[model samples]
Target: MTEGRPLRADARRNRERVLAAAREAFAAEGISVPLDEIARRAGVGPGTVYRHFPTKEALFHAAIVDNIERLTDYARELATAADPVHAFFGFLDHWVAEGAVKRDLAEAIGSDHALELSSPVKGMLDSIETLLHRAQRSGGVRPDIDLDDLLRALKGTFLVTHIPTITDAQRRRTFAIVFDGLRVR
Candidate 1:
């Protein structure tokens, strides 16, 4: 019932508020935060939140999709940078830093239902791959590294080092070590 038609101005405002509140709540409290609490935080009723998102998983998926879209846009913009290798690793560092607070959404990205979401996840991946190829062609990155290899290393590092207990300095150190391994020998 909530699909197909365009939302009225007030309804659109409420939906944005719900998403912002949900992102904050999920970041601070994990994905287990209650819908009613999110509604309260958003200054809207629970029914309003449900009307827009349908279910908690749907809301979480939407949030992840939003994050991915932002990252994709960032990568696209970085593609035009003068130094291809700097742009590529800069995007990776930016992503890892942002993931410190938004780590809760990472699991949802890898979830079975992620593909069903509306976000352009594939486009984001393609952007990264393009960056990697550019860096490889310029001899700034190792010849053997591919998109999958970079993704695995980056995701693995973030998953292991982005914990609440880890200091920002520690995260930076870990990222530096990881990036060192990716650089051309």
Candidate 2:
């Protein structure tokens, strides 16, 4: 170990703790949450939190990336599920839920030059393509549909379905309508 330059294990722990707390704080309270409150939540000094994150946007980027990775994993799981239809709907539900979190993170992460669309977005799109292909082959989704149009429609659904006050039931209804329209006769 480099005695003079190395951060101790305890110091490293504090850094991670601060990031975790900041994520929670930002999720609950947005980017305007006090650094002092975040430090208190982490059981660290404000300086330590500041040292780890430097800016609120930097902390938000960490949280956003973490969340995107989780969503990506879920997409991978859904892509390989036993029932292709169930997997597709499960992916949609997960997308909506994650989109809510992304909605908040986007306000900060969108403004930061550091943030970019993660590869999972592309992976998820490809997964959706595979699912749609399978469903179409099985006479589930309509054969006449263009994949790009389908993707655009689903993205439109994401935007429409993002309202905070909308119940899951409402989302289900909306999803059903969308699914019904896209299904083969």
Candidate 3:
């Protein structure tokens, strides 16, 4: 997984499998998912995972970055959609739905750490701001809200849904309330 260096075909496949497994595992179970578990999920040996990612931090960061990059890209794409109101609310719904169960995603962007405020995260924030501004201008979202407000609301939604005992019905109800608060009417 070295930069600019090509891996052998089998090695590359193994790496890809490991990364996919890591992403899915982290998304579903958080960073605490064991390397061995990831290996089993990938159908590779634990040594293969270690070979590609020497440390859990390395694998975790890579998976988190990949997920964040994907989310940012999706938001940027939606920024140009014909309906900003739909795009903005749909994106919020997507995050609330996925982030509720994605512990690693919640932890990655939910923090105030140095890395959390840098390029990757900033890119996502910019996209969200674009959608938020467009929606506000269209009178679909409350004009009083800012990026920080929306982000806080998103974080709160993620946290509340992460409660182990929260039912799916309750989670949906919670997000319905939060989303209603964000809407203009």
Candidate 4:
């Protein structure tokens, strides 16, 4: 029903604006922000937003996929750090802190069946697993822990620290306590 060609310059600009607005809105207000508000923020009409993203779910999924890809890239970069243990824990700390404000995004990814199967998500997990294995082999992490343990610890940490009433200091303290448990005795 549509031509399979590159978008025109104006159309491409409009699409980029829409995605940028959507990312900001989703980060500040979660995925519940109205499409019209996103369109207004992008200086585009609602029809233009709809033309670029057929539904809010589609837009949110795109954002999540984009985030996963970026995180995977970051993990890949961290993988080459001189200290494997520091690299692993640094990645974990950064991930949990970033995810603290993106609780809605976490919930959406957890619930979305399609997103769970996405290659970016899988790549992120694999990268994490490799990091964990490297740290363990270096005797920095406890040998008994595996990738699943690390994931569960991060999920638990995020769930516990992401509450609105919790102060930043409290979150850091809690994360420190949990993270300490992962180190070799």
Candidate 5:
């Protein structure tokens, strides 16, 4: 889609289907899931998957960008919600939950490919920052905190979620601690 002027309606639909399938497949089965399996899951021919994403790295990069774009959009919506504090904390909850699932895909793609994701990651961080500022203005979040600090804490939380056998209660407690620290006491 990025190579052309624009994708036609049917072509756009095909690409989206492929991406949705790829995201689920990669997240569930890792990048080792064959393109043929992705196409089968998408209900499209294998050639269609290649047409949209020529290589595994290309497809993975697209999938990761697509996920970030979606989260950014969601965060932007929540930023203007009636309860800024809830929106901020709720976004963090959603983000961490998503990271727990997506960790496999990121690991399968390897650290080398992750370096190309700066742009979309920046957009995600900016959306979080907007929500943070809104929450702070509402006197729910700590005024002294900044996006950098929040990002560091979020990264650490994501890492914690990578623990091989962490129970759900442990995960919740970990997040509760982070949330408690960020909230204005």
Candidate 6:
């Protein structure tokens, strides 16, 4: 039996299970969910969890990145939307949802946004930049605004969800305020 090949299938299944469990746990209880609980939810031992992800933080990072890639794909579709305003709002809604889910990605990834986002980030940025350019051409968003600032603001909004006892409605209201603020006067 090939040494590496023998473990490949089992390893892939374990990783997938761990990620699914971690996603549910994080969504239900935020980032503070215990690793042991995640392992139990996955029907795996704690040692297996460790073998896959050494720390809760690392597992969280993986989940966050996975979610980001999916969102970025959605953003790609939005970029081609016929309505520029709708496209912008689509991107906005995506950021808000991802923020609501994992408030710590911005902190772990950093302001530069180079981390956590690999090729998918680049693809999304290209789409976003093109869309922003089109919107600017149509006199939608402010011409003076930079995409980097928008990204930082979006990340900031996500970070706000981590605050204790903030309701989802409150987060939406805050996002509305920021969204209106970003619009061209």
Top candidate on lDDT is 3
Off by over 4 Å in 5: 5-59, 104-118
lDDT sort, best first: 3, 1, 5, 4, 6, 2
Candidate 6 has its poorest 10 consecutive residues by lDDT at 107-116
Pairs that collide in candidate 2 are none
Candidate 3's TM-score reads: 0.77
Give the alpha carbon lDDT tens digit for every residue of 2-103 in model 2: 347867898889978987887787765566678899899999998887776778766766766676566567767776677776676676666656555555
Q: Candidate 3's error at 75, in angstroms?
A: 2.2
TM-score for each model: 0.80, 0.58, 0.77, 0.78, 0.66, 0.74
lDDT by residue (84-152, candidate 6, tens digit) is 876887687776776676654445333443433556456666676777776766777788877787777
Instruction: State each candidate's clash count.
Output: 0, 0, 0, 0, 0, 0
Clashes of 2: 0
Per residue, candidate 1 scores C-alpha lDDT tens digits across 1-185 of 35689999999999999999998887766577899999999999999999998889888777667787888999999988899999989988788777777775455443455443444777778888888888888889998977778767876776777566888889889989999999998
Off by over 4 Å in 4: 1-3, 34-36, 100-113
TM-score comparison, 4 vs 6, better candidate:
4
Clashing pairs for model 1 are none
Q: What TM-score quantifies how close candidate 6 is to the native fold?
A: 0.74
Residue 142 miss distance in model 6 (angstroms): 1.8
Cα error of candidate 3 at position 164, Å: 2.9
Model 6 global lDDT (CA atoms, 0 to 1): 0.72
Q: Residue 41 CA error for candidate 3 (Å)? A: 3.7
Output the TM-score of candidate 1.
0.80
- Candidate 1 wrongly placed segments (more than 4 Å): 8-10, 29-34, 104-112, 115-119
lDDT of each: 0.80, 0.67, 0.85, 0.79, 0.80, 0.72
**Superposing all C-alpha atoms, what RMSD in Å does each candidate have to the true structure?**
2.8, 5.2, 3.0, 3.0, 4.7, 3.7
Can you tell me which runs of candidate 3 are displaced by over 4 Å?
Answer: 43-47, 112-120
lDDT for 169 (candidate 4): 89
lDDT of 4 by residue, 111-133 (tens): 44465567777888889888888
